[model samples]
Structure formats: C-alpha cells, structure tokens
Target: MKILLVGAGLSGAVIGRDLAEAGHDITIVDSRPHIGGNCYTERDPETGVLVHVYGPHIFHTDDEEVWDYVNRYQTFRPYKNRVKTTSQGAVYSLPVNLHTINQFYGKTLRPAEAREFLEEQADSSIADPQTFEEQALRFVGPDLYAAFFKGYTEKQWGCSPTELPASILKRLPVRFNYDDNYFFHRFQGMPETGYTEMIAAILDHPAIEVRLDTRFSAEQGAGYDHVFYSGPLDGYFDYRLGRLGYRTLDFERFTDQGDYQGCAVMNYGDRDVPYTRITEHKHFAPWESHEGTVCYREYSRAAGPDDIPYYPIRLVAEKALLADYVALAEETAGVTFVGRLGTYRYLDMDVTIREALDAAAAFRASAAAGDAMPAFVKSPL
Candidate 1:
C-alpha cells in the first residue's frame, strides 16, 4: 500500500510509522520546514537553550501506552508543570488552591475551611450555569473570578466570560488543597533534547519518505493508494462551506540574563498586560543550564488566512460551519481526516498521538478485512 500523509505532524508521523512497519510505503509532506509542526523545538543559537519554537507544550497523560511510545524514541525527563499567575497587583499559585485563597484574603484557612469559604462566596442562585462567567461565579464567586479568570479569559479567548460557554471553564480546576501542579495526569515529562528530534526518529524508517517545506494538495492524493489528510478539514475543499473559527497565537521573543521569571510559565491575569503569559524556554528543560535565557510573551487573537491556527474556536457559529465541512468530508473518498485540525478540536499532545495510533490500527484492520476506510475514525461533532 502506498500512503500519502498530508502533514508531517504527530498524526502523519505516527500513522506513517505504523503503516510503514506493516509493509506499506509512506510519503509525508509539510509546508513547514520542520517535522513536528507546532510542537517543533530548536536550540537558541545565541543562548544555547532548547526552545519550544511555538509556545510551551508540556507532555502529560494518564495513558501508559502513549507514555511508553514516546519514550522509545527519546529520553523522557520527569517534569511537572507548576504554574503561577499574577492577578490583582500580586502573584499567586494557579487553580485557586488554599494558599491562593489564604493569600488573597489574608487568612490561614486549612483545606476544609478554604473549601467552605469558597462555597460561601459562591452564588447559590445560579442553579444551571450556561456561560463561563455564571459558572465561575457559581463555583468561586465574582471576586476570585474577576481577579484571576475574567481578565485572563478575556485576553486568551478575546471575549468576555459572559459570552463564552460554560464547558470551557469545566477544564479548569478550583482545588481545595495547595496542589498547584497544572495537570492531573499520572505521567508528565518532556523529551531530553526536543520534540523535533524525537519526531525525526519516528520518521527514520526506510519505507517512509519525509519532504519538508512542501505543501500538499487534494489533487496530489491520486498517486497514492490512500491519503491520510491531517491538514485543516475546511482547507481540503478550499473552504467552500466557510472557514471555521480558530484562535492563533503570536509570540513576542525577548532575551534576558540568568533566570527571567524563576519559572517556566507565568500567567498575567490582568487584561491590560496585553500578553496572556510569559514563557521562559530555558526553564522548560531545567536539567540544562545557560547564562542567557530566552522567553516569549504569548498573545492570542482570531486567526487570519495566512496565520498559523493554534486552537479551534468551537463556538455556536463555528460548530455549524464545522458540520458542513464534516458532511463534505464524508462525501469525499480515498482520504481520511485525522488529528486536531482535521477534527476541528483542540487536542493535547497525548490525545493527538493516541488518536493517530487508533486511526492507524483502524486502517490496518480495514485493509485486512477488505472493508472501506472511514473518513473519520472519531467524530468531529
């Protein structure tokens, strides 16, 4: 079988690797000059610090299989994400824990007491919260929401919390204890060198050919037996239905001597601050040290035609547009849509790899049974 993968990101690389191992020829093409897509990492020429080229990507997952799969290619250094946010003229730990509650209110309340205090502060009137602001007020009340979430949410999503969906806030946590670790995943780590090198190792098979700085088109799918389209779903048909909404990020890079913020990620909860967060690239790999440090001030905005799309804005309007695209995708043949862009969802690194692995297995099973491959292994809606 000859497979043409549209993008050289995790979806293409993982699927291509699996198919190649199964005696299939795989050709991967990417418009970007690198293999890892948005997760690409490179060392700073001047500072010698390994930098996550496009914002920070912390690998954290509860799936043991995904953890083991990545470890096979590179050394997995144990890492935990401890995030801090500056809000209301002071700095505090994130997730709104006991320490944060105590610090903000000037009280030494314990875990249980803090929980009760937040409960008291919470609005009991809103029984079924639909908006992000209502949800926040119901859970943590207006004071904490205004201080920590309101400004930050407005900055990140470029909208008021009142306009956003309640589902968005569900991903966030309001911990009772002092646990500040960002994720609840069991396995959390980063590659020793960088994501690009690890991805390069995955595509090193003899049956797989990787072409960088090459853009793939729907017309090019004729040469191969099948096509794995990991690019944007709307892009395949030239966005005939309409372009789906996406939030793109812009990084403002700067240099500093020694440690800049003494942390990997520092969130600015104030909307007036302009940038959402400041990421110190050197702190991502704390095992390595350098005299000079590299950092990026991340800014979020609605994606334009030429901008790189970071997150799918699956609001009411975008959902309808995505449905039209999915219907069109289903009518098409010889191409399978996979990954974040294909499915029009914001996926974590582990979730993306897991889906890629599943898609590969499904394709192999379909081939063995002489069944037709699905346009989508997982539903976009």
Candidate 2:
C-alpha cells in the first residue's frame, strides 16, 4: 500500500516509520524546509551550543514503550524540569511547593504547616470553581495566585484568568513538599543529539521517502492508498469554515558569554513583563559543555495566517468550529487526521507518538483483516 503522510513532525514521522516497517511504501511531506517540525534543534554556529530552534522541549513520559522507542533513535539524557518564576521583584520555585510558600510568606513552615496554611488562605465560600481564577484562589489562595499565576496566565493565554477554564489550572499542581520538579512523569529526559536528529533517524527507514519543502495538496491523496493529514485540520480545507484560534510564540534570541540564569527555563510571572519566559538552550543538554550560551525570550500572541501554530486555544467557540471540521474529515474518504494541529488539541510529545504508533498499528491490522480504516483512531473531541 502507498501511504501519504502530510507533515514531517513527530506524528507523521512515527506513523510513516510504522507503516514503512510493515512493508508499506510511505512518503512524508512537509511545507517547511526541515523535517522535525517545531521540535527542530540545531547547533549555534558561534556558541557551540545546541539551540532548540522553536523552544525548550523536555521529553518526559511514564510509558516504557514510548521511552524505549525514542531511545532507539537517540541517547536520552536524564533531565528533570525544575522551573522558576519571577514575580513582584522576587524569584520563587514553580508549582508552588513548600519552599515557594515559605519564601513568599517569610516563614519556615513544614509540609503539614504549609498545607494547613494554604487551607486557611483558600476561600471556603466558593462551593464549585468554574474559572481559572476561582480554581487558583480555591487551591493556593489570593497571594500565591496573584504573584505566580494571575499575571503569567494573562500573558500566556492573552486573557484574564477569570475568562479561562478551571480545567487549565487543574493541570498545575500545588504541592506541600519542597519538590520543585515541574512534571511528575516517571521517565524525564532530553534527546542528547537533539529532537531533529531523533526524528530524522525515525524517518531513516528504507521504505520511507521524505519530501522536505513540499506542500502536499488534497488532490495528491488520490495517488495513495491512505493519507495521514497531520497539518492543521482547517488547513486541509483551506480554512473554509473558520481558522481555529491558537497562541503562537515569537522568540527574541540573544547570546551570552557564560552561563545565563543558571537554569533552562525561567518564567516571568509579572504582568509588567512583556515576555512569558527566557529559555537558556544550553542548560537543556547538561551532559554537553559549552563556553557560551543561547537563549530565547518567548512572547505569546494570537496566531496569524503565516505564523506557526503552537498552543491551541480550544475554548467553546473554537471547539464549535472544530466540530464542523471533524465532521467534514469523517465524511471525507482516504484521509485520517493525526497530531496536535490536525486534531486541534494540546498534546504532549509522548502522547503524539503513542497515538501515531496506535494509528499505524490499526491501519496494518485493518489492512490484513480487510476492514475500512477509521477517520480517526483516537478521537480529538
């Protein structure tokens, strides 16, 4: 079977690799000149530091199979994301742990004391929290929420925390202990050789043909037995209904002589601050030593037509538009939408790979059983 994969990102690459390995001919196309999509990383010419071209991407997953799968392509260096935030002229550990609580209040409180203190600070009047601001106030109190989350959330999402969903705050954990690890995933690491190399290795299989700088069209799908569209869902139909809302990032890059910030990611939680975070790319790959450092000051704003879509703002209005596109995709034949943009969801790197693997496996099984391939193996809605 000849398979057409439109997008050289993780989703298309992983799916293409799987189908190719199953003896199916695969051709992966991307509009960009590079293959790794937003996960692209390359070495800085002057600094000798490997820069995350897009931004910092830490590979962390509890799935052992996914861990092993990526490890096959590149070396996985043990990495833990310990984030910091600067709010109101003070720096604090992120995820609002015991240290952050103690520092913010200027008191040395134990885990139990900190927990009890937060409980007292929490507003007991609100029975059920609906918005992000309410959820934060319910969990961490006004002071903590104001200092750490309120300003940052406003800048990141381009709206007030009250307008955002409470579900967004649910993903952010408030801890009683001093542990500052941003993510709780069992396996946390970065590809030693960088994400681009890892993904390039995945697409290196013999049966797969990668076409960089190629813009694949819907009419091209007629030539292949199956078409995996990993581009933006609305993009397939050329945004016939409406363009989905997304927050795109603008990276203001700069170079420093020595270690900058002494950390990988330092988030600015002050509303006065223009950018959201500053990412020192060298700190991401700690195993390698570099004299100079490269950093990016990240600014988030509404995604435009020409900009690359980063985070999907799947608010009520956007979801309504997404439903229309999903219906169109389901009714359309010989096409299966996959990945973050295609599905219009905020998916982690691991989840993207896992779904692609599953999607490919389903295709192989269906082909053998003479069953029709699904419009989507995993539901976006």
Query: Per-residue alpha-carbon lDDT of model 2 for 44-157, expressed as tens digits?
Result: 999989999998889999999999999999999899999999899999998889999999999999999988999999997878999999999998889999999999999999
Q: lDDT tens string, model 1, 1-381?
A: 999999998999999999999999999999988899988999999999999998899999999999999999999899989899988789999878888999999999988898899889999899999999999999999899989999999999988889899999999998888889889999999999999999999999999999989988888999999999989999999988879889999999999899999999999999899999999999899899899999999999999999999989899999988988889999898999999999999999999999999999999999999998989999999
Local distance difference test scores for all models = 0.93, 0.93
* Residue 52 displacement (Å), model 2: 0.7
Pairs that collide in candidate 2 are none
Q: What's the CA error at residue 156 for candidate 1, in Å?
A: 0.8
How far out, in Å, is residue 188 in model 1? 0.4
User: How well does each candidate superpose onto the true structure, as a TM-score?
Assistant: 0.99, 0.99
Candidate 1 stretches with Cα past 4 Å from truth are none
Q: Cα RMSD (Å) between model 2 and the true structure?
A: 0.7
